[model samples]
Target chain A: MTPPILELSGLTKSYTAGGAAVAHVVGGVSLKVGRGETYGLVGESGSGKSTIGRLSLRLVEADAGTIRFGGIDLRALSGRELKRLRRRMQIIFQDPFSSLDPRVRIGTALAEPIRLHRLRRGAEVDQRVEELLATVGLSPAHRHRYPHEFSGGPRQRIAIARALAVEPELIVCDEAVSALDVSIQAQILNLLEDLQRDLGVSYLFISHDLGVVRHMAARIGVLYAGRLVEEGPAETIFADPRHPYTRMLLAAAPRLFAGPGAAPRTEIAGAPPSPFDLPPGCAFASRCPFAEARCRTEAPGPDSYRDAGRRAACWRSAELPPQAAEESTARMSPAFRRRLDLLHTARREALA
Target chain B: MSETPPAQDADTSAPVLSIRDLTVRFGQAAPVLDGIDLDIGRGELLCVVGESGSGKSVTALAAMGLLPPAAQISATRMMLGDKAGDVDLAGLGERQLERLRGNRMAMVFQEPMTSLNPVMTIGRQIAEPLIRHHGLDAGEARTRALEMLRQVHVPAPEQRYAQYPHQLSGGLRQRVMIAMALVCRPALLIADEPTTALDVTIQSQILRLIDELRAELDTAVMFITHDLAVVSEIADRVAVIYAGRIVEEGRRAQIFEDPQHPYTLSLFASMPRLVAEDVSGGGRLAPIGGQVPAPGNMPAGCRFAPRCPFAVTRCMAEVPPLAAPAGSAGDGHRVACWRAPLEETLG
Candidate 1:
């Protein structure tokens, strides 16, 4: 059995505010992505989803915790070793316009990475650039075009092509398709899925859009105020969400159909609390309709649920109103639970 | 086939605003907008839906007499109707147009962060239109501003009125923009992608607020957006635009359930629904290949012909006139296609 491609143990990232005190943007968190597996990290703004993605690739230095790739501890890697590792772990940014250099042509942008990685050079580099461009559905003729010449969708394709230039094993896509139109977003998602299947690349896809995540991700982790509140298989999370925070997020998501003749929408009542001053207990306790006095005082620790492989940080998950828990929990029978537990235990032991 | 009511049926007496045979060209070049005709009845929310560079925004700007001097806008008739008597908005003098700008026809623009005056207090911003358009005193204007904020469902109107644009959230700022636009109770409101910058939950709130305001004020609305779902929610009727021309116009239900134009079908198919596995086979996406052609060099025939699966020699040779969809609800549903959908036979 192979070790997970990327693993984080008790990762914590804190930032010092203007005053005397330090603020923990991301509290102690732990998650991992295996080789060729897509892990989705979902959260609202300021949830530290983006920060965790950055921390994984060492884009932002984590305050404390261990991030290991294969057998190597990323934190312990020095200058040269770190440089080598960067080629294997790449990141796609949120804004294509800002991420890309305005002055450089698409070909030049794609070539720079290959040159940095020393993958190829001379005519070989030029030929590789054209091939990469064609791979992302852009014609080789578009290599000379600047960022402004292309629309949002094409610009994203160019970004993807640039990410693939070095042939990285893992790419952290941060809100990669959020800004594009709905139709265009589907195209980009499909492209990413196809690329993943063909290239066997792992992705730490970070976004607030759950629909996109559900379609592409096998496992999903819900983050809030830098802490991992819930982590489970995408279908189980969507079908029978045990965590109150996860339920709230699912409820808040705008649905397609709702009223008579109109589609139902997932409407959230209030906004998330500011990250600077988070509440004790659950980060979502303030907005939780079912919050009790105990909820405000004690933060629930992560616990395995109906499926031993599924984990959620919530006190009253089993106590969820009948209808809310009916569909998902009903599907999780004893036989399925035993199977998932056996599979996960084997995978964990192999990693250890 | 049954026909849904036209968007203009709400006001059978006359349209609040109407444009006929409108042609707009920049300099001596070919017309960017060619013979676009539309009507906005009193209290009707008619969304002009299109992608970027589709001239939906341009149409609204033209209605407001805001086109550049270089744009040669010539329409056989562009009328703004009310009980006072319809006026030719296209023919109005600059001073007359200025008077009508914020008084009778107000617009809530996209990107409220930039559209709003950064330095002005929310109260003062909302009061500006009341004072200037209604000739109210500053004290009275401020009072009216508070009322406007309340009307738009801004919580704690008094405190919010004193806050600046930068201090408000994206949703709140858009609401402030709405309050400013509606303070004078304009007969018509033009919102250009007003909620595009907001989150989904916030977008719905804004849409619901707009729906409520339109009902209360009996104000006509011309909403411009690319989100078809939003159009389905708020628009009584929708006009599908491409390359500066309206390719189709129909009642909301008719447009959604039985679209006539190939482009319209493609646009709906392209949108990713909230739930996966509902429509469009698993892993199969319905994205339109290729980019929108540069508006400056639009194609001679149907602008959508290049991407249309049903394109033919005739479609490439000449422009298709906007006509009633075959077997559709009378003139209520219109399409600009050489061939409409054969769904009845195929399905």
Candidate 2:
């Protein structure tokens, strides 16, 4: 297997707000992003998923741990060296409306990144900006427009164009498509997939939406209370999650169209333990339906199970209540399916 | 939980609230919502599904008589309850509307933090409605507020009652919001993307809570959301809104099983499947090209015609009336598309 583009081991971070107790937002979390791979990091709000995304890019300095990007230890790099390395990594925020400067034209936003990185000069920089606009499926005419002039989708496109201007090797997309509507989300997802295929770029795809994460990533990592609970192939994890938290997430997620045989999702009644005072044991034990006595007293490390490629941090990973094996179908009508088929054809022809 | 909450089977004849030919515009500009019609059935959940700028929220605000004074609003027949207890929301004055609002109908918005007063205790915030609308005294209102909080499943209701909005977590705060909205047990409840700001885990629970509350209170619910999954999860009936118009309406089964409108079809196509693979192979969704038409830039004919793949000359030149197709099951499923029965016409 090829080496991962980004790797973190024993990543830890803490924040003390308003002279209160220090909260370990991320604690000893370890993960990797392989070259030309989309690694999905998914968890609910305050689960440290976003923290990991920022830490990987050195946007926030970790209190302790090692960050290796393409075999270079990021912690050892000086400010100048780190600034040079920033060219290879970019981050896209959730809100496109607030991310860009409203007064700045889209052209200036795209050009600034290229010029700052010194990737291009005068006319070449402008030319590259136009190319980027085209790359994200926008027109060069849109260059003159301000952020307010563009809609959510176009603004997001501009954000993407700016990210690509420096030709980053890996991009951390933190809930990138969560803000847009469904159709626009599809467009952005498709565009990202296309860009990955064409540019051979990697993405550290962070989102709370499992459907979006599953759509983007080949492998998935589930985080809970700043800890890595499970990591595996998307299909395997989605089909049969070893970690109880992972299963809870799947059950909570609403299917677009559910068939009659679909299993009822098992809901976790209480909220996650407070980040400031997380219990010593597994962070999900309180919510786990099959939690054993040891789960509350002893913390479990990320242990391999099912296969070497799959891992779950659970004491009772071996013995849990069996899941209803019914594969929920879309319950799609033949009539509806035909229209979808027609849509694919029409869209293809339109592209042609 | 298992979805389809048994769809309360609300009676059509005596709907809790009904609006016909509702049109809304802002200060001489183009109409934001034009000729909108909807019916909130007694004890049934009707989801108004549309993207941003599609006027779903505007429709709700107009119904509640909450639209700004500068806004121009007109409707042929907008009333609550079909029988002798009917209240004409369109013709009512602000003072009359205020009395009818919390007493007859109430609305919940996306963010509880914005609507909820941070300075006020959770208990007091909830008690305000009871005091103002029901004339409940201080002691009675306080007791009722705590009871309301407990009903929405907030833990340790007594402890929570004393705390302010900022002290509670988002889920608990939202439970507070629901408690405040339903404190009066109003006949009609309009929740506009109430769960959109929350996580999926919290979102489903809130949806279930709302579903449970609607059934218990027998309040007609107009649940507005952009998510098709959430819509299918909780809706008894579905209304597809596009560019300020109802393009389709149907029962949950009818809408999911046999969608007819091109926009609905496109929305279904656009959704990312939860399963391992879908039509475009893994991870890819079929995007509907272009955006929802901005207000002033709306097409003269069909609003969706510009982005629609099936757009024809007739579609661009004239608006198609929303009506049931010839072979459709008795009036339940309707579509506003010139080229519907698409398999026969286009295939």
Candidate 3:
């Protein structure tokens, strides 16, 4: 088998307060992003999904772990060599407004990465920048606008173009589309898919939004208090999530059309355990509906669901009752569905 | 426009809070809320949903009479059925509005951390409204605040009472905000994206809490959100706002099930479905280009026409009136687009 584009094993990171490791932001996470595959790292805020993304890119140094980028050990590499390897990896943050330089033209922002990587030079560099803009569906005229001059959606497209300028094989999209409105988010999502289809770039897509993640990712990793609780194909996980936390996320996601009547979305009672003083058990055990005495005392290893790639960090996942496939969109009334069909067809015909 | 701005049943009864042709602009800018009318019954959960700068929050602030003094506000009618009787909120002086605020009408903002008093104990903050509005003594106010906290289901209300806003979690601070807002049992509660900042699980809990409180207190709730999914879950009626206009307004079923406006339909098509995609995959979200125009620089005709998939010359020239389609029972399902009932026109 081809080596995964990026692989992390036993990745751990803790933020220190006053030189003491007071908070374990990321604790013992392991995952693999296959070549050109979108690996979704999903969790609530402070769950350390972002930390893992940063760790993979070596943006945040992990306290302990092995990071292999296309078979090269990132941890053992020297700083200078790591800097060079950085050319092959890039990141897009949630907010392009702040992530971008206010004073710089959008064209300069895109050119800086290309020039730094020496992907293009002189007249060719300017030409490449224009090409990048066109690639992201932006006009060359937009290259002259400042970051603040553009709206949220366009600003994000500029960010994406910047990410693409480096010609990286893998881009860590840390909540890239989370800030945009629904319609705008759809545009960006489609753009990302198109870019992936054309460029064959892998993405470590980290988002707190499950729906967006479900749409963008082929494989998913559920994070809880800095721990990876579940990792599996997006379809199987959504169809019948093995882990309680995964099920909780599925239950909590706001669905537009959940059959004819509105269904009351459920929430589990407790907050995630503090990373400062984690229990000597599953990080989600406190909130897990099926947690037992053993689950509260002993940390369980990854329980294999089926293939080597599918697993849940729960002692009872194998014996747990199967979750009914959660209801979501497309339960439209016939009238609504008919109208939507007409809308889709008309929009398509016009675009065509 | 012969028709009045389309109106909802307001939960099948007389409106607890009614506003008509409300227009607001700051300084020399264009109106942020352009002739938008809204109604909320005694216990209705009306959701005003739109993207950023769509006048969702401004509408709430305008109704609460909380806009800054610089806002040049005008309205045909802004009536609130306060305990005192029906009062025109627009007619009230700032001082009069202040008296009615937190007493007869309350607001809960998106970020409770900012909306809440950071320096004050959560308990004191909650008790202040009771003391100010109900004329309760400090001790009585404290007791009532604790009860309110409990009602909002804040764990360990006694301990939380002594905690500052910074000491509590995001969800807890939100609960404190709700406790404070509802302590005086206001006639109307305007929650503007109250859960947008929270995690999904926490957001669901807060939404559930608001739904319960709205039901129990019969507080006419104006829930402003950009999330159509959230609207589907909690709204009794929904008003889809765009560029300060209510482009479409209808019952939740009518809006979600049989929306007619191109903007509303596009919004529905644009959202990525949550889970069903796994079961039946091969689906793509409709891509509607163009951002919501800034208030001061809105388009001439249909606000959404710039990005509309089916826009024609007429859409660019004529501002479609917010009215029911050509032939339909006037079920308060109004749409502001020339190509309504798209199945008929497009198909």
Best by TM-score: 2
Winner by TM-score between candidate 2 and candidate 1: 2
Q: Cα-based RMSD of the predictions, in order?
A: 7.9, 1.9, 3.6
lDDT of 1 by residue, A79-148 (tens): 7999898888888887888778999999999999999889997999999999999888889989899999
Which residue pairs show collisions in model 3?
A: none
Q: Worst 10-residue stretch by lDDT in candidate 3 chain A? A: A258-267
DockQ (Cα-based) for each candidate: 0.18, 0.61, 0.48
TM-scores of all models? 0.89, 0.97, 0.95
Candidate 1 lDDT over B200-294, as tens digits, reads: 55776788889878888988899999877677667788899987788989877667656677667666555544225432233355566666677
Q: Candidate 1: list runs displaced more than 4 Å.
A: A1-3, A21-24, A251-267, A302-309, A322-352, B1-11, B83-85, B278-280, B344-347
- Candidate 2 segments whose C-alpha is farther than 4 A from its true place: A18-20, A259-261, A304-306, A321-327, B1-13, B82-84, B274-276, B280-283
DockQ of 3: 0.48
Over the full model, what C-alpha lDDT does candidate 1 score relative to the true structure?
A: 0.78
Determine which window of 10 residues in candidate 1 chain A has minimal summed lDDT.
A325-334
Which of 2 and 3 is ahead in DockQ?
A: 2
What C-alpha lDDT, on a 0 to 100 scale, does residue B213 get in candidate 2? Answer: 92
What's the true lDDT of residue A310 in model 2?
A: 88
TM-score of chain A, predicted model 3, versus the true chain A, to 2 decimals: 0.95
